[model samples]
Target: MIDLAHTPVTSVPGVGPKRAEELKKLEIESVADLLGYFPYRYDDFRVVDVAEAVHDTKVTLKGSIYGTPSIRWYGRKKSRLTARIDVNGVYVKVVWFNQAFLKKKMKTGETVVVSGKWDAHRLQLTADRTWFGQESEKHVGRLEPVYSVTSSLSVSWLRKTIYGAFAAFGREIEEVLPQKLRSRYRLLDRARAMYYLHFPKGREEGVQARRRMVYEELFLYELKLLWHRKQEKAADKGMTRRLDHEKLDRFIESLPFPLTGAQRRVVEEIVRDMADESRMNRLLQGDVGSGKTVVAAIALYANWLSGFQGAMMVPTEILAEQHLRSLKELLAPTGMNMILLTGGMKAKEKREALSQIQMGLADVVVGTHALIQEDVIYRSLGLVITDEQHRFGVRQRSKLREKGETPDVLHMTATPIPRTLAITAYGDMDVSVIDEMPAGRQPVETYWVKSDVWSRVVEFIGKVCRTGRQAYVICPLIEESEKSDLQNAQAVFEEIAEELAPIRVGLLHGRMSPAEKDEVMRSYAAKEIQILVSTTVVEVGVNVPNATVMVIYDADRFGLAQLHQLRGRVGRGGGQATCVLVADPRSETGIERMRVMCETTDGFEISQKDLELRGPGEFFGVKQSGLPEFKVADLLEDFKVLELARADAAEILEATDWEEAPEYRPLREYLDRFQKEQAKFD
Candidate 1:
């Protein structure tokens, strides 16, 4: 049997400690790890003749190398060798590299089969592989598998180890899949799959085995997610607060302008959801400048009328500050008390804010992730508004709800998601979309120009600043790197500041300290800085009405949604805003991507296309706000599977929640194991 404890790799016949260390680099620590290392390729050698072999040619020829080889040292780094191999009706030269000792093996004419590359120009043979075996030509059977190898590990040792492991207890590792489930899922038994996958008779069988295993892995992962959803629903707290429309109506009317059609529709939905008893966990998605903040403000006001406090959580301190200011301005006429709690707040100011919150003095609390911190409790928090929902996790959302007795949640996203995605990703929650941009919100004009047009681009920003307006210049990096050609925020900032010496300009990047970032952003927002050069840190929540020009350096490096977001930083004022995209002619695909931003300003269209092209991953998401990130099932392609799984989970819960039903025992065990694995491994 393959001894899990004592069977060292070298004991399998060839590998020693030095070789074992090499295998360990490939994550092959034990006999099992080595056995499971699969191949990425296979080579078939079925046809070959000895005499037909020529120099500089790779052929599988049945031949014999009888003459001793001569090795010649070329340079400090190079070596050469030559030998005589007798082939089908002819003789050929066999060449080896740095193996001068092979010269001891010649007696005029001994027979040995060889396989190597043919050098046609020099009429020589370069060894790729060679063997002296029983067969001359007839059916040596199938192709040899070629596995992925690192510099430290060789394919020969890996293959030998797997075969050695299999020789012992190969049958013991076979899957224990239930017959009914296997037949239903059309899956292979684990043992049979391992055999075929590692040593298939042909290509077709190997492919079939791979498909079966991948599908099984995905299916089980999907099934577990559905089970978790069931547990959540069964434990639903169901705390709904009645929102008075007139209380919110007064607050809405207090704003400078009317709500857009999209905003009104979302407001009605939130109010309706809050009006009922089911806890409100809804998503509010819309494009830039779609008026989601006003909708959130009105919702908070409704909570005030319900005799409870409200909380607004955002992704960053800058965004939290922006919301704090916007809510204060929007609700000032209605006399709502809005307070801010961020990481950078003064100790005494934060203490006062906390005291005010606990005593029900602050009507609405707005901040970054700090809003959900312990010791900052509310007397009776009825509503929780999370902006940029993808930035936070599901557990974080639950924690926020824990801050209250299951407070109603309203998630906000400036980047819109597709319908199928909404249904699959946020399957358990209701959705509201602010599809229409507010009236008089002029679309920002865009330009895609080559780097050769740099002079003209600088002039455009200057002209906008000369008109007493501000502008934003964006770069993708913090500093130039030897690995990349993109411009950094600091270099661009310095360059632009010198280029436009008379204008007040500033710099901001992710590496800046939190206090420094806030200070710079504060200056830019207050128009103390007429031009701000930044990285994608400017990708969200900056409201500069006077800034009408946005210049993105290396525009093609950003995704479509990201491009749309950076472009959104402009065009918030009465004058026409311009967003210029600078790129090189060589980046055709990148220009095509940025065109989405130029062609349409809708976050929904761009997000939909992006989701279609690149499915759900860590790169784009709602965890930033307080939503869960999916691991296996895609929000776009496998949306239907999600719906089916969700519904099935619901039915299972209704029949027997918390393992109250005997039929759910298997699934429950699977979930328990899965959770334990994620916790331990991840």
Candidate 2:
């Protein structure tokens, strides 16, 4: 038995440096990595008669070649090797695309086994894989593991490499779970499970092996989460405040508009959490235009009433300024002074703001990442709120929280994550959702228009502007990238300005300076600009009640949740609003995505559809949604396993601390190793 982790993949026979580099692309660096690289799917080697094979389905057939395989080239780049196999008395055509070398290897009258998709449309079998030899029951009557491959690595190479590593280190596969727990779960021993998972004799064996592996993966993940949760609990004491209901009532009454029921409920949750002995680590999720800012303001006001300082951090300087202004307007009656401390501020201005913040002259502070700089000190920071929470990574949020002694943290995001994913991603924190829209808010009328209908869309925009309302034209790119065919913000701005002559059109994107962006947003809000051409940088914080039209170019490129958020830019003032999506996608999925945009305005519904379409990895990946990557446990397909792992982890933690138990030493060490590896990625 060898140390699998210390043994590199290159040590495997036939895996030179070149092959090792290719394996590295799949994150397989060691013998242990190779063993853990589970197969994505399995293939059945049970041979069936050619006549019994169903069309459009994968099947294996064993027969002898009736004639020599011939290479046919449809074009200079298009070619296929075709052969006819004799099965009993029926003849089935087998085809392999672009592999002309198969013609030389497969001889007439030679026995072969082929597996492929039986294409009924062409009445031919398009071979995905093939083997040449006498059909033996050992290889033809069992299940085979099929691994995901790269262009440089073939399935056969991966299989051979894994087997070679197993031969060398199979005995070193240590068991992390205790024997008693394994018996309770009816799980196979670690070494036997690996063998059965890689090379199983039957479907049941493969299924059981996979189940065992899935449980192990999810159990380890849940256990780590439990550990992290405990660490958060044991952190230094946090702000424990008393609520001033009279002050809250006066603030609520002073507001021009009433808070929605959902908003009120979420605010109550925040207030309750803030008063608890433990710190309030809560995530506030809401759709666009749901008045999340008001709820956040109320929370900050409560902290202020307790004679504690509060901070709100946004992703962009434009957003930070916006929050500063809006909070000033909302909290004017409370007589609390709030100051802005952004990186864009001049030295003199920044010095003054820092002095005020440090001396407790500023009750509330709003800024970008500059608020977390080492030089910035708080007099008595009690509450920390991060707007557009997905845009900030775990490190940034942690840095801000470190400013105070376990400050009550509140994270807010307009990006509507699905309920299940929210639970999984933010499992360590409490969650509150603002599901209801504000009163008198109207649903934006949405439409899907083809690119060819650009003239009509322009005409509509002009009409809306002529009616004294503003419009937004959102392009997917700041500047045209060679890889994408979408319109850029500058190009679209020029085109719209020229087409709609005399109409003041402003441009905004991420590339612009923060001051420049603020200028454009201010102009747009003041109605000095009738139409605004921009990128998704305007997706979060800018608000204008008069903007009633939203035209998104290449809208299909955006997820449904984002498209919904863009639509939310309009219809803010209870007037009729319209959202036009310009796209002409070809795939059924793409077409369905556009259709979903036109069908609903509910952010949660759109997010659910987005999750179903993109899965958890892609959904979280689209934005900087901070979630730990699980190696084998899928939040969707293995959701039940996740639930089981969570429950089991709670029970185990209640019984004993694994680190202190002699029998659980192996599990604790394994968990430590896993946490260290996961931290490298974070």
Candidate 3:
């Protein structure tokens, strides 16, 4: 197998020294790197000769050039050249644009063919030559690899270098899948899967090969995850605290509405783990609006009630602020300090908060990554909870644990994972799910609508904002772009502020300084801003219960779980909230995806559906979570394999008493290298 980390791109036979540097510009560095650089698409140009062209028929014609190209320059930087060829008494016109070299290269009366929709031209047949090349055109195939390239490197060269690597080192890469599973899945041998996918002669073959590879990726990812889980769970031998139902019951009853059965189940599971002497490392899986926050709050509050300081870490200042509002309300009667800490606060203010925290005046401290700062000391940190746990890498979570003298960890994610995948990726932690919405939390009326429906929605938002209800308008991009249809955060901000001039408009996105973002969020939380235009940066953070409307532009661009999270941000105040999915329905694919979001709001069910629709590796967002990247597995698609791997890993770990087993030597070595790689990612 090619070790891409140490091997240079020039080592690939065909890539030579000159092309190797150019390839580096594209971030392609080695054999393993090139192998994963799959084609964006396949362009097929296999067809018959042009002599059989009908009057207005569309067809692909491939043949040798039969005539000399004449250069025709009209205006500034304008050019055109045409070639005439006779084939079976039919004269065909071939036109070229700006190919000055072709004028001197081609000889008249050589047999050449061109392809496009045949058109009638003043007593001659004519067609635009969209498909043409030299000798290569003569051997058209069922599938042609179209590569993404810079001007310095040609597609043919890339294809050749990539092809050579696969041919030479393909078999060297180990097959991670067991034989029995491979046969059951009907997957091709690992080498064949790579070869066929890269250079298949036919479309069907390419599809089959790609499917096998994709399946392998999903399966292996799951296995690695489950393996990680087993090791973590097995290593957990520390004492855990229990604050049972009495504490949880009080919080639940204090709420205006009753806790959903799903919420109760998760809370009970949390208490169960806390009661055990072993440290509780658990993941709370819930969808947007699944009431995960309340359940998490209960765990933190329980730890505090039992005389331990609890810490809640969120990904963004906006989310941290949001959690603070909800937790403050929930822990109000409990008289917990419920202190807040974020990177955005004034330096002096932060210092004071730190002083209070060190003084142990803050029982439950909530903040973003600031909680993990080396200078921020904790007093008896017993529990650490991270919302949207995927955003933080494994070591980052462990770092927070270090702050609390090895605090019992609780990781929370609103992203729903399929059962098999969960066992693989989060296997180390026991799973608790908040599957139900609290009773009387009106389901946000959701819709996947085109731009035409927005005028009324905007008016409605204006009305809602006027009535003391806040609205969130989420744009897909942070700023304007020439290449995408999703409105930028800035554009949406300007548009909304213009549309509702009377209402105070606020903007929040990833690009803002943490302090700037915090101020905007705090203003929104205070209801100083009536309408907030934001990017998905606000997806996990920024809780404004009085905000009753969520309008996500380019809604189709987001995955189901994410859209659910954004939707969950609203509907927090118990009053009815509306989730409007504004998207372009011009494309059937875009419309179909949006329809799924509108059809059902169940996060777990949607997560499974998303895996089926978009594959497991993409089950989360496209942004790679800072984990060791796996080349052959996906957590979503290969859940079963994950379960098996996790079980096997646990067995091996237990057998060795956590470090004694010979079987774990290879895995331990891999993990050590992987940990270094993860540091680079950080």
- Highest TM-score against the true fold, candidate: 2
Name the better of 1 and 2 by TM-score.
2
Q: Rank the candidates by TM-score, best first.
A: 2, 1, 3
Candidate 2, 521-542: lDDT as tens digits? 8899889999999999888777
lDDT of each: 0.74, 0.86, 0.73
Alpha carbon lDDT at 324, candidate 3: 88
Winner of 2 and 3 under lDDT: 2
Cα-based TM-score, every candidate: 0.70, 0.84, 0.63
Q: Judged by lDDT, which candidate is best?
A: 2
Off by over 4 Å in 3: 1-16, 19-40, 43-142, 149-152, 158-176, 226-257, 272-289, 301-307, 313-363, 366-377, 387-399, 413-433, 445-682
- Tens digits of per-residue lDDT for model 1, 570-657: 9887768999999873666575676676787778888876666555553354443223443323456555555554554455545535
Error of 3 at 306 (Å): 5.6
**Model 1: number of backbone collisions:** 29
Write the residue-wise lDDT of candidate 3 on 220-322 in tens digits. 4444555555545567665555565675676778876577888878878887777777778889887777777778888887788777898998888767766
